[model samples]
Target: MKIVVSGQMLKYQVRNSSTSRSSPSSYGTASPSSSSSNGSQHDVTLLTTSRSNSLVSLNSLDSSGPEGDWGVLKVYTSDIRQCTDYKTIRVSTKTTARNVIEMVLTKFKLTCRDPNLFELWMELTTKAEGKPVKTILRLENDAKPLELQRCHPAGMSRFLLHMNATGTLVRVYDHNICAASNYKSLMLSSLTNCEEAIDLILAQNRKSREESANYGLFLTTPEAEAQIPPEVSIVSVYVLSQPQHKIVIRPLDSL
Candidate 1:
C-alpha cells in the first residue's frame, strides 16, 4: 500500500523518532479504516510552537504603527538661565593687580573690552594713639601703570586688568563709572577697605557655594567654569577717572 505524508508530518515524525524511544507496546498498528481516514485529513500538527514568538511578531508591527513618528522626532527646550554668584579669592598688590582683576572678572561673569580701564591704588594706613591712619596711593604714580585692555574674541566679550607687581592695593574701574550701572554700583562704596573688599568677595564666593549646595544654580556641576558665547566679543576696557578702577564693554554674546 502507498502512504503520503506532508512536510510538517514528515518533520514531526523524524523529530519524534530521534528524541523519543518508541516501545512496541506503545505503538499499535492503526486499523485500515482509521489509517485511510487519517490520510484523508489535510490538517498537520506543528512540531514546534511558542506563544512568545507570536508575541514578538505582534510587538514588531505595533512599534512601526502610525505613532512611529513620535519616536523619530525629539523636542528640546532652551537651558534655563543660571544664577551665578562668585568664586575664588584673589589678593592684589602692585604686581598682581592685573592677575587679580582677570581672576575676579572671570569669576563674576564680566567681560573685557578695548580701551579698557585698569588702575591700582593702595590705602596706606598707620596706627595712631588709639585709632588708625589711612591714605590712598596710585600704583601708576609710583611705577609704570599696568596694562589694562579689552579683549574682543569671536562670540565673547572680556576685559583684562593686569599688573605685574608684588602685593599691593588695587581697585577696578569700568566704562560704566556712575552709580547707576549694576556692576559699578554693586562694587562701589560696598568695598571701602582691603579687609572689606576681601570679605565682600569671599562673601560672594560663599553665597555661590551655598547656592550650589542647595542646587539653586540649576547646573549639574557647580564648579564648572562659564564659557563665553561665540557671537559676542570684547569691545573696550579702559581705566576711568577713578584712581584704581577699570571698565570694559563687549557684545551681548559675551555673557
Candidate 2:
C-alpha cells in the first residue's frame, strides 16, 4: 500500500503480504515511559506479514523521529520482493556533515578506515521549528570501510616515489623546458648531430654495458624531458662516491 508521511513529504509503498506480527510496543509510542506508566508493557516485533506490515512501516517512521517539524523519510517496501530488501532514505538537515556521516556509518556498522574515501557533502536548511535540520550525508556505492596502515618515514618516501612514478606526467613548457634552456639546448644539439654525448660520457667512465646497470645512462624522451624546468636544464652533473664527498662536473661542451 502507498504510505505518504506528512510534515516531511516522505512517502513509502509496502506490499500487503509482507506484513509480519509485531508487539504493540514495537509499534513505537511517542513516550514509552508514559505508556508503561499505565501498567502496559510493549514487546519488539517485526512486520513482515500482511497483518503487521503497516505497523512495521509506522514503527520505522517513529524510530526516525516524532511526528512534527521533521520526520524520517518514508521507506518504500512494496517494490521490494524480499523481506530483507530495503532502500536508503536520503536525509537532509542542518547538522554537520561529519556528524551525519558518523551517524550513517554507525547505523551501517561501518568504520572510517579510509580517510580519502570518507568524504561527506552536506546541505543546510532551516526547519519549520526554526531549528537547524540535521545534515544529510550521502554514500556513493563505491564508499566502503578502508583500513589505512601507518607508514614509517622511509616507507612514506618510498610510497611518494611510487606515487610520483605512477602518476600522470604533465609537461609544462615554462616549468619544464623554458627554464632549463642550457640543458635543453645541449640535449637537442646532441640529438640533431647524432652525437652520443651522454653515451660517450658513460663509456669514458667504463660504465657502458649492454644490459642496463643501476648506474647506466639512459635516454629521456622529449615528453619526459619537457617536465624538467628551464632553470634546471643546465648540463651539470654531480657524482657521489666514498668519503661522502660530491664532485661537480660539466659537459664537455661546457668546457
Candidate 3:
C-alpha cells in the first residue's frame, strides 16, 4: 500500500513506447495497433481552436465543481508496454460503456468473455487540465448512456484494458471500494524510492478500487505552503471529446 501523491511534476513526457507516435489534438486518435487493428472509419479533423475546452468540464466527474454521482475512471493493463494492475473506477453518469465493459469483465474474473468481442477505448481530452493524453472512441457495441456520459473526463483516473486481438496488454482490476478520509491522490512530480513510490501509487490507484469519496487524483494538490513552481508531470492525462467521438471494430464472429 504505497501511496505518496504530493503535488505534481514530470513536466509532461510519456512514451515508454506504445509504439510512440500520436498526435492530432482536441483529444482523439485510436489505431495504436491495439491488437491486430480491424475497425477503421472514424474520422475527425478539428484543431482549429478558437474556443472549445469545457463540455461542462468535459462532462464532469468531480473536477471539484459540477460532476457528481459517481465519475471516476483510470484503468491500465499492459503486456508488452509493461504497466500493470492499476484501477480506479466509479461508474454512473448513467453507466453503460457496455455496463462499464461488463464492469471490466467482471473485475477480471473474465466474466466468460464475448462481451461483443470487447472494446471500450474511450480516451479523449482537451479541457486543458494540461493536455497530452489521447485515445479516441472505439466503443461501438451499442454504447450510449448519453454516449457514455458524453465521453467523460474532467481530470485524473484514466482508462485502458485491451486484450481483444491478442496484442497482449492484459492486467485489469477494479473492485471500486475507496475510502480512508476520502482517498485517491498520488500525483508526484518526481519521486525516487520506496519501490518507485509503490509503482506510482499502485500505478495510480487500486487498493481495492474504492471511490465513494475523495473524488479523484486528490484534485491536484499543489498548495506547497509557499515556494511555488512545481506542477507538471502527471505522466499524461487528457479527456474532452465529442467530434461525435466514434470508433468501432466489430467483426470477429468466428470464435
TM-score of each: 0.20, 0.16, 0.21
Misplaced by over 4 Å in model 1 are 1-95, 141-255
- Tell me the spans in candidate 3 whose CA falls farther than 4 Å from its real position: 1-67, 71-74, 79-88, 91-158, 161-255
Q: Pick the candidate with the highest lDDT.
A: 3
- Residue-level lDDT of model 1, residues 59-175, one tens digit each, is 233223333322110101011112322232423123234444444445545532111233333222233332222222223322311211111122121111222222222333222
Tens-place lDDT per residue, model 2, 141-179, is 222111000111211110000000111111111112123
Global local distance difference test of model 1: 0.25
Our model 2 lands, by Cα RMSD against the true structure, at 25.0
| Superposed Cα deviation of residue 100, candidate 3 (Å) | 16
**So what's the TM-score on candidate 1?**
0.20
Model 2: lDDT of residue 77: 25
- In model 2, the Cα lDDT at residue 101 comes to 44
What lDDT is obtained when candidate 2 is compared to the true structure?
0.24
Model 2 regions more than 4 Å off: 1-69, 73-92, 119-255
Per-residue lDDT of candidate 3, residues 1-255 (tens digit): 111122221111223222122221212222222221223222223221111243323334333333334656655544212434545567655454567667766676654344444555544543223223433445444443333444554542144544444221112112222233333333222222222223333434443223212222211223321111123222222022123321111111311
